[model samples]
Target: MQRKRASHYIPTSTMELERLYRLLVLAILVNVVRGRFLPGPWIYAAHATFYGAEDAVATMGGACGYGNLYQSGYGTETTALSSVLFNNGLGCGGCYQIRCVNSKYCYPGSPYITVTATNLCPANWARPTNNGGWCNPPREHFDMSKPAFMKIAFWRAGIVPVAYRRVPCVKQGGIHFNLQGNYWWLLVYITNVGGPGDISKVSVKGSRTGWIPMTRNWGAAFQVFHSFQGQSISFMITAASTRETVIAWNVAPPSWKQGAIYMGGQLG
Candidate 1:
């Protein structure tokens, strides 16, 4: 009889204790609500507590905030998506990550990466006519022209005889160039014209058509500043020459490291 009694008895384990506790709580809940407890309200509350508030905050934040991170050409939703895309370096064609900046507008072919901005105030923002003006539109692009300045500077101080003749062209060296605020300054030593004729007529024509003339030119120097994509600059020298006029050019390479200037004019 003792063995039978022991066999009939079941042990209460830790898990069983938990189960009993839950059941007891359920009974208390059922009595409190009088069998009126509904799962629909609980689920609704849970969802609203998280998702609903999240959506509300996002909308409010967007309205108040100046901008947000997003994919180029897409809004905030796209920005979030691009974070994943760029991290994978997807569709970049094996290019390693160099640098990235957050801006609304992006230049095409710029080595650095960019993030799109979502919102902007019209009065404060300056929009580009073509594409990729910082915070303008068509957001996210690479701009080769945006790099720091590299320059080529030559001086008339030193001289080296070429073919046993003292040449007007003297010491030539290059320096890095930077686009100054609204103007680029260039100094060149030239003969074949008097009164230190201005070369200010020089202009840079981008890959896209259209030319912007130099603002100031004096002392055989030229000053020009225009939006250009590291293209060829045509320097038209308006000297008081009889017939043959001196015209030269300089090609700004795609790589900002190399700056070149061509000085071609026969001094009489």
Candidate 2:
């Protein structure tokens, strides 16, 4: 039997070499092609093929722009202006404005001021459903994935207080109690203050005499009308125990207040 040896075909002319190079490049691209490119796709070109350029531009906002595009308005000066960016670049007309906010159009849904989380507690104890301050939040994004717990300090707009009072809690204990249930709520409070300030993590001990997992009710720094209301969380101890629950709120931050007296009463 005779074996056929593979032949290596080489191009001759410059044109042929270029053509071969192009063909090889095209083949590599074809082999790697899946659906579309990442970071940004060419959806507009596909739309234009079917709907035409003008129609595609009007519908999906012309190419190169961030969002939907609109034409000039009635008046000359007003009409002269380019696109206006709105809704996080959702609506664009003639001109572009970075980070423009339109109060007339309310951004629907829950307004949650997302922040990083802490180790001692679950994510829920971070912030409330509807709560925010007058000034814009410092950072645009809060990455919860890093660190045990994020230290969020909130300060009020104005301030004027001489001798701040600190309230004392009658009983320092977790609020929710389940002798043989799945979940429990921790409600602790603090007293003696005059303005918004920071609060540390509270220690929770179950009736069975084991320290239960407890996190801060609110962020580290927040404005309290008067006394501090710690976070209400659901948690389980290393092992379930039932005797007489004893919980206490300890100022977590400032390290010095590690074992400071808690003036707030504990409730479920």
After aligning candidate 2 to the native by TM-score, how far in Å is the CA of 236 from where it should be?
Answer: 17
Estimate, for each residue in 175-228, the C-alpha lDDT of model 1 and write its tens digit.
112232332443332222221111223444444546555543322234554544
- Candidate 2 C-alpha error for residue 165, in Å: 18
lDDT value, candidate 1, whole model: 0.26
Which regions in candidate 2 have their CA more than 4 angstroms from the true location? 1-134, 139-183, 193-197, 219-268
Top candidate when judged by lDDT against the true structure: 1
Which one is best on TM-score? 1
* Model 2 CA lDDT for position 51: 17
Give the number of colliding residue pairs in candidate 2. 30
